[model samples]
Target: MKDRFDYGQNPEKTKGGELIAAYLCDPETADAEFLLSKAKYKAITGREQKKNADILCYQIRQSFLPGEITPEDANRIGYEMGMRWTKGKYAFFVATHIDRHHIHNHIYYNSTALDCTRKFRDFIGSARAVRHLSDRICLENGLSYIAHPKLHSKGKFKHYGEWQDDNRPPTFQERLKAQIDSCLAEKPQSMAAFLQAMVSAGYEVKHGRGGVISFRAEGQKRFTRLRSSTLGKGYGQEDIQAVVEGRAASSEGRGAPPRKVNLIIDIQSRMKAGKGPAYERWAKIFNLKQMAATLQYLQESGLLEYEQLEKRATGAADRFHVLSGQIKSIEGAMSVNAELKAAIMDYAKTRPAFKGYEAAKYSKKYLAEHEAEIALYRAAQATFRHVLSGAKLPKMDALKAEYQKLAAEKRAAYRDYRAVRKDMQEVVTAKANIDHLFGLTDTQKNKEQER
Candidate 1:
């Protein structure tokens, strides 16, 4: 950024190529013109070709060293990258050894196409691929490469308000859950102990409409947990006691039931893989041990009532495991096909024979045959990719529209199940609270035993 300079929208140094070649030798006029024409400048910058040409000249020296490279070494590296990356159907420019700060090259390749089509437009993820290419080039030469800024920020996920880059306020549920979690985390225990801990943490609890509960800290309503929704995972003593007993308790007593427990874990495995980029959305969704634990928790707590009644929901979850395997296979095949296509197309681009059958390179027929193979391979690869993408799923035009429909139905089912469990737990928490905290009378005990 610091080194790059502008020469307006057009270049005044018409012999910019000669300037580049000057590092190796005093380039002849004919050779300079040939270099400029080879740059394919018009194809790359489109209407702004000359502007790009000037910038390339300005930046080329920073890319490599002029005094260090031998003439043959410069030619070889230039020829090699040209062969390795060029798309056979695109116009590309290449120049080297300019007597500037360094003996580097500039390539003004037609970012659009040589197939005389805009097929590359909106094509895959190639738009931001230059960073990968630049790093790869430095790596190939055993040189240090600069890291892209966005790539470094990719994994910084946090739930804190100050952590958010966007200024939007957190959803009420999110704020409430954070507060509840903070209070309960003072100490960890079964449902009763957690409620007792919340009380000790100086939270004043009160009931809200629709069976919800609010906890205020320092006279400020900082948290609220819903009683019956499959929302945040906090529960009040009443909410916990009501679950195991199969009904909300008439009064706090000593007839509480046992608490339900669940486990969560993240697991990973490795595979022998090749050089292509693999798509793995399914991998995050499918972990056998975690899924098994979740399933057992749901069953022991009676969370999936409809699935338990018909025995279909657990089976559907099992099918997701199978789907994960299929996705892995699809990604592997796509990787192989795409990599092969790039390698072959690049070879043809710099091979001279494909450039209208120059004798120094392969024959035009040879390049034609490779293109035919790429077409066939691309077709087959796409079919497999579509199949593994779960063809049975309905197409989603809007992210929220799809999430809303899926999450709503799933949450409704989960809510019914969690509510039943919560009712039972509330009975346990209430009974425990009375007996332990307030102490029970003989008559109250007799009544609890009578039930």
Candidate 2:
């Protein structure tokens, strides 16, 4: 139990212990507290709880999808789940670990009741109950949860990372969309030719009532209707007809924005790996389309000249960095302000207890009775000493005003930061595509700039 607690509260995993939270006990001393509870249980019941027969604590691991939750929120969610599960009867601590790609929480709660008169017993279907409770909490916090979870043959669910690794195969609708995209890329001359092209690509096309076109791939049980409602707007019969007649642009018929231009594959390298003429032809066409898109974007952005495009890309990158630094600075100030505010409130609430202890001349009995309050007061004093040094503490109203001002500044900076980041990304991507198309290496680019 101690080993598990140590592992869960590893400083490296929990951001140097910053992401740890406890309820009813100090997290650092929680193991000792649990041991103390066991001793009390033995004294009350006259039964020494054997290590093998007794459960020391329970650990719940709650994981979040990568990038879906922040570490602080994960810790809070874990703490809330523990409180709900234990009903405030147990002491627990939640340690949020961000050492892996996915953020997860490790909650360890004592098995003995807070009063040390009873022990928690595991019941049937408790695992399912925990899962349902976790799902409910996740949804309440606006996080996604698996609605229909599948169990493995062993009657257990796969690990989160394993589930992510086993990416589901593309659905029938997705496969059909890809086939349609490929057929459209060939620029079929007529609807008849388009249907024929699909047939050649291993699809069975059917002309249904009201001129509705349906298609079924090999081994498919049912034919999928190629209607605006079924296959989305761009794959509708009318849209395809317009594209065939050259009445609408191919991109418009596809019902999606143009894909960003990307670097072309190295055909020579691919051919050395045994690619045939058909593959080479496809690669050449793909490269041609990408170059066309690149040129169009350059024309629209007024960056036809390489020098102007390079300069704009550099300026966009610099602006993005400046905005990012500003947001970080504002966020740091807000964190300090929040911490100080909390300390001030804690100090105020515990002031009466500290004064009574002082009046009692720091009597042992008084100190024992008011231990928690005195500890809180001392913590707040330490915080003030560290944060304010010798300076006078600011008023709560002043701190609140400062925090609000910093938050407003952060919001404004964040908006500009997002805009600058997007601009930087687009400009940088365009510059990279241009370099790849022109076969310009970094050394060559530097030489050209010098020239």
Candidate 3:
């Protein structure tokens, strides 16, 4: 799960930035987790899913509360998070959130520490690497992970890594409202009590106008106006009806749970064996989400056909795959010389490992100097046998020659381009010099001479 949490100051209590910072960053704090963005938050996801979100902050908090602090207490929280994660060493980068709904903590940390240093280490320049770490942290901490390509608002739905902001997940309040409303009826007695009841009943409550409480339950809305008339008048028609209707209106619990969403990666993990509710929740994390749909809607702006989404996704995948394959090939090529050198060194270090039994004391380090060509020779012999036995394909000397020829041609082409560029510069200089001289000479009748 990937998540960003806003640890607030109990609203009625003192708001201290230092305490939150100290708690979150204090290398020794426990029960803490971090999130990279609010993209998949109930605040974000619930809106599109159920029509609204229920988040309160988007920035890091600094107090005794958890998950909302930073550098001010690094070592303490580092050790704390590390111990809970059961990994030695940890590192998390703090971020500032400008969104006011939630004063959240964005955590980017590692699960394991360096074996050599025992201190958490990270590749500071890699966002992808950080995402992996962020995903791991979310799962371990029961947070949600967001996949990239955030969905857009007014477009046909896009898939993973394709959605823009318009199709993003529901906002926090929406989700909160839904969870609160699940199999729940709004209690008009008091807003706070109504919210508390909803929460206890596994619903996330949202306050509406006229003291009305609105929430979503099983994909539908359940709203009721709050009033003191019922209590003061010893229950009116609506109240009498509510008591009679609330029971009749009470819905059967789905008996399942919410799904786990990976907004950043557009992935949903399976529920653990014992976590029934979670399994139900994660089961819903599918290929298509409103965020993606929203993006698709925005992109196409008309009734969508299945083929278009598939086509775009397939093309994008194929292109990325090609790039991935090329990268792998380049990496292999870069390692060739190193591998050849290492093989030669290995042959020298342990000559007996091969057919050659050179019996002389030698330094282990000698392997670094000579094993490559030796391996090549051995390979050639194997190839010769393979050809003789007719059990394997014959070696391609033509291919080798062609490859070397291409390499040489490439080098030559580069040299030629450089030479041509230099010559062009010389020509330009000569022309400039001629112009300077002619200007001093003052040939005023050049127009007629040209004709």
Question: Which candidate tops lDDT?
Answer: 2
Return the TM-score for each candidate structure: 0.28, 0.52, 0.22
The stretch of ten residues in a row with the least summed lDDT in candidate 3 is 112-121
1-451: candidate 3 lDDT, tens digit per residue: 2233233322222133332322223322222332222222323223222224332222222212245443344324433433344342333333333234433433334332221112222333334444455456555645445643243433244666454332234443434434333424453354345456656765544666654544444444553323334222312224323443443232213232322222222122333344466335533432233333334432443324435434543454455455455544544443443344433444344345333423323334443333433344465455445434654432345435544665665455545545554433333322222333335213553331221
TM-score winner: 2
Instruction: Determine which window of 10 residues in candidate 1 has minimal summed lDDT.
Output: 1-10
Q: lDDT of candidate 2?
A: 0.83
Model 1, position 199, has a per-residue lDDT of 72
**Which candidate do you rate higher for TM-score, 1 or 2?**
2
> By lDDT, highest first, what's the ranking?
2, 1, 3
Give the candidates in order of TM-score, highest first. 2, 1, 3
The lDDT values for all models are 0.41, 0.83, 0.37
Residue pairs with colliding backbones in model 2 are none
Per-residue CA lDDT of model 1 for 33-132, tens digit only, reads 3335435335433433344443322122125444555544554555444434554443433455444455555543333344322222333444345445
> Given candidate 1, what's the lDDT at residue 344?
41
